[model samples]
Target: MENPWLKINHSDYENHMIEVGQSQILNSLKKYCLDKYQPKNFALLGCATGNGLEHVKSNVTNKVYAIDINQEYLNKTQEKFENQIINLELLKRDIQNEELAIKNIDLFFVGLVLEYVDPKKTLNKIIETIGKNGILFIVIQKNKQTTFVSKTKYKSLETLSDISNDVNENEIDSFICLKNMELIKKEEIELTKSKSFITLEYRKKE
Candidate 1:
């Protein structure tokens, strides 16, 4: 089976997301965080082509770290935001890896990326990489049992509870375990023209 995250084309997906207003999720995330902390540096875990970067406050944020596993995605993001002059750093990294070049992040954004990684360890790694009291804004697909095929494979809202049953289990509960984090705020949004839903999970250091 092919890895879905690796198969994503950042440029294409970013363009589509922007056109469809799917990128609004990033804007919402920024608003949710800026309301709480005055972060100087921001890290976007799955910063695909840096689509919604323009929404980030330039004066408050001096640097933005964009990390993705696909080199093509990183390259596309770098090229797209090359002239933004926001000190953007495009990094090609498998987020599952424990080692990272940067740490003590002020704000960490994980958007629609956790479902593809080992959720438990991924959350722990994210918490470990950020500073104390730092903010983590995550947006994950809620349902995974009823697969739907529009342009991608996803689950229906009805089965969300079943799939998330073991919130503590390792393999079957990728989405719900995220809620175990010390939540600061959370909201649910239904996608346009899809059977999928998004759960925005926000957290602060415990």
Candidate 2:
């Protein structure tokens, strides 16, 4: 079956997220990571249409890898950042099925991506690509009272509900520990009374 993400229109997805007040939150989280870490090399998984990539500065983050499963999203991201961001590399890849060729990323952002893919496989693959002592920022949505797909004017976003799975924070913490990564911090940002985003910061051990 084709991934629902591939079928989602960029505008619809963007509008839906914006309406739900998630895009801005995501942008803020990215900004926080970039400002605090100031990583020379950065990568964003599930980088749809470069939502938070504006935080990337050529002087601070020299290299950027923006990856997404949708080609159209990648095209839009390239159009927006190709001239602005130096060494911006855009890749269209299915993290679940394809082998990631990237390595040595100083900081990696996996925001709301693990829910759509096989969490264990993708997490393992991501760990392999991080440089020693690299930082990893993961954002997982906690939908205790809300549906997996938030209601919006754009119904196209609804297709994602079929593939979206809830990720357990404890499981990831345990898995990363076994993989030689230590948790730097865990923060919970409440989006709504029932919905929140849990941000986990991890660092690869030397």
Candidate 3:
């Protein structure tokens, strides 16, 4: 079966898209965490085409594990960042699958990926994989409900809140509970002609 996350087709077109706005978001995320301890091992979710891979300082990041559901996108990302020599391990795995091997992630970067999966399960897996002192950087989209279409399924920020509400009732008291993780910083940015973006930095409890 084909993966839904691997949606981009043309490499040039994807690169253009990244160059325009995605790169800006990636830069903002990097700047927020650059002062933190240099991450030796980094894991990125929804790493499409590896455009932001180049932004990660080589001296700080020795190994990077890029995960995406689509094999095609993974292949593209691997080929695009092959010369970086950062021990990039491209894995084709579904985030919902609990059997995947992921642990001790110094920095876990998830951008516009969680909306596609079961938010509660995805957060549990992420919290489990990241070390006690590790950090998680997330970028989520916010907008009006009518902006989304059936052909392209994208969850709004309110939808994410709803998912968090369910998790709070069934599992945790709050999605961004300070007991488990503490929010260090947050910034909201607007895109060219779409929804707003919010980047959050969270430090896991020791």
Candidate 4:
């Protein structure tokens, strides 16, 4: 696997997501995260180009582990937030690999990433990394569509057209509860009139 993600331009990806009302969705996520968890330390899985990063408040979140598999994306994040965040940690790791560690994280945000990894195994690994009383946030598409290319195309992301896979929302929800992760809150963000994504907040059971 070439990791089509590495070919994606972080700026273009963020811009496209913004056009799809991702900013609004991320804003709501941020509000819910801060009001509910108030985590001092957190991790943003697949934190590409720092989209939705504005929601991370300095006073509330002291340390952030901005993780992404692609080095270019991490590089952009470093450049964008180097001066803003006081204690920032950039981790380059693949979520599908067992070597990826998120141990003791107060909050974990997995946005638009489960589609690419083995959901159950990856979730298990991530849960183990979350400390007791920690929170995990996941964003999953309500509607399923694979093998589709973007309306706004970028030279780097052209290769992503070949990607095709299913991330069944129902299956994901089932796995979350099976792992003793309780669903605290769930909301659907209408990205478009017809397309939307559901955000599920799960807290560690013990």
Candidate 5:
């Protein structure tokens, strides 16, 4: 089955996310998560058009793997940051079913991508790929907005409404505890009148 992300154009997705205050969420993510633990090697899962790519300090976090399901999105990310990023790896994949090719990453960043996939499987895949004591920085919509669908019209994106899964915060916490991972940090960011995000930072059990 074709992924919904592959159906949406990067420009359209970016515009919609910005319109719905996704950039603000990214700002907080960079502030608390990216800037604090500047990992030497990291992967940005669901990195559509590579938002928050600027937070990586070349001298500190030089190696970055940008992974997404859509080829067009990865292409645009390459065009945008191929010069600034020293070791940029662009991976096109469906992470739910595929093992991450790169291993021992210091940080794994996922931005609102879990809602589209089976979170447990995706989380397991990520956990296996990250090194012991590696960080998993994640953000998910805390509450249902007017709808999961973009208020603005876009055929490819609007279809996301059908497949969108609700992320249960309590269930997430339970899962982390069940896996014996430590919850290092967490925050809630209110982006817009109708939008908010619950961000979490977890350290894998060594």
Candidate 6:
């Protein structure tokens, strides 16, 4: 199966997210995790064009890993943050297929990525990389409309509709609990009249 994300440019993705009023909200949510967790080692899964990376403080976060399947996205992130962030690593690998080499990461952020991949397989890989007591911040979209991809001027984003799937909160909770991770908090942010983002924060048991 072809990955639609690779075909879409960062500009188109960002524009679509902005059109749906998700760019600012996503950035704020990522900032919230950074402030609350205060992690020394931070990892962002499916980091698209590094939208929320501006909030990372180099003094607090010594190492930052930005992983994405698209090499173009990784390249853009490197061009933007390579000088600003200390010890920044950009990985071009699919979370569903490749083994994540990151270990002992204090915080892992998975935003709007599970819908495109196998949740169980990806979660297993995530658990392997998170350190003891590591924090996991996951954001999934809940749609009131039948279409998973919201209408936007950027037609390139329409390709994602083929792979995107709606994820249930209860199913995610059950999977994480079985892995010995406990939910710290959960919040739902309404993006538009027909769309909302559900964020789940979990901590690995020591």
| Top-scoring candidate (lDDT) | 2
- Model 6's TM-score against the true structure: 0.98
RMSD of 1: 5.9
Per-residue CA lDDT of model 6 for 125-185, tens digit only, reads 9988899999999999999965899888899999998898999988998999999899999
Backbone clashes under 3 angstroms, per model? 0, 0, 0, 0, 0, 0
Q: How many clashing residue pairs are found in candidate 6?
A: 0
Candidate 2 stretches with Cα past 4 Å from truth are: none
TM-score against truth, every candidate: 0.73, 0.98, 0.77, 0.88, 0.92, 0.98
Pairs of residues clashing in candidate 2: none
lDDT of 2 by residue, 51-105 (tens): 9899888889889999999999999999998998999999889999997899998
- Writing each residue's lDDT as its tens digit, candidate 5 over 121-187 gives 8887887778878888888886644676657754568889777887987688778767757898777
What RMSD, rounded to one decimal, does every model reach?
5.9, 0.8, 5.5, 2.2, 1.7, 0.8
Can you tell me which runs of candidate 6 are displaced by over 4 Å? Answer: none
Which residue ranges in model 1 land beyond 4 Å of their true spot? 1-4, 15-21, 31-36, 144-149, 152-181, 192-197, 200-203
For residues 17-82, write the lDDT of model 4, one tens digit per residue: 766566567756766776678788888888888776766778888888898988998999999888
**Model 4 regions more than 4 Å off:** 144-150, 155-158
lDDT for 168 (candidate 4): 73
Question: How much lDDT does each candidate structure score?
Answer: 0.63, 0.92, 0.66, 0.77, 0.82, 0.92
CA error at residue 11 for candidate 4, angstroms: 2.2
Ranking by TM-score: 2, 6, 5, 4, 3, 1
Q: Which stretches of candidate 3 lie over 4 Å from their true place?
A: 6-16, 31-37, 149-173, 192-194
Q: Candidate 5: which stretches are off by over 4 Å?
A: none
Two-way lDDT contest, 1 vs 4, winner: 4
Order of models, best lDDT first: 2, 6, 5, 4, 3, 1
Candidate 3: tens digits of C-alpha lDDT, residues 1-206:
33434444636435544544655676557655644657887888877666567766777787888887778878888788878746889878788774448788888988776656676677777777787788888777655443422122232222323322111121322575534887777777877455566777778888
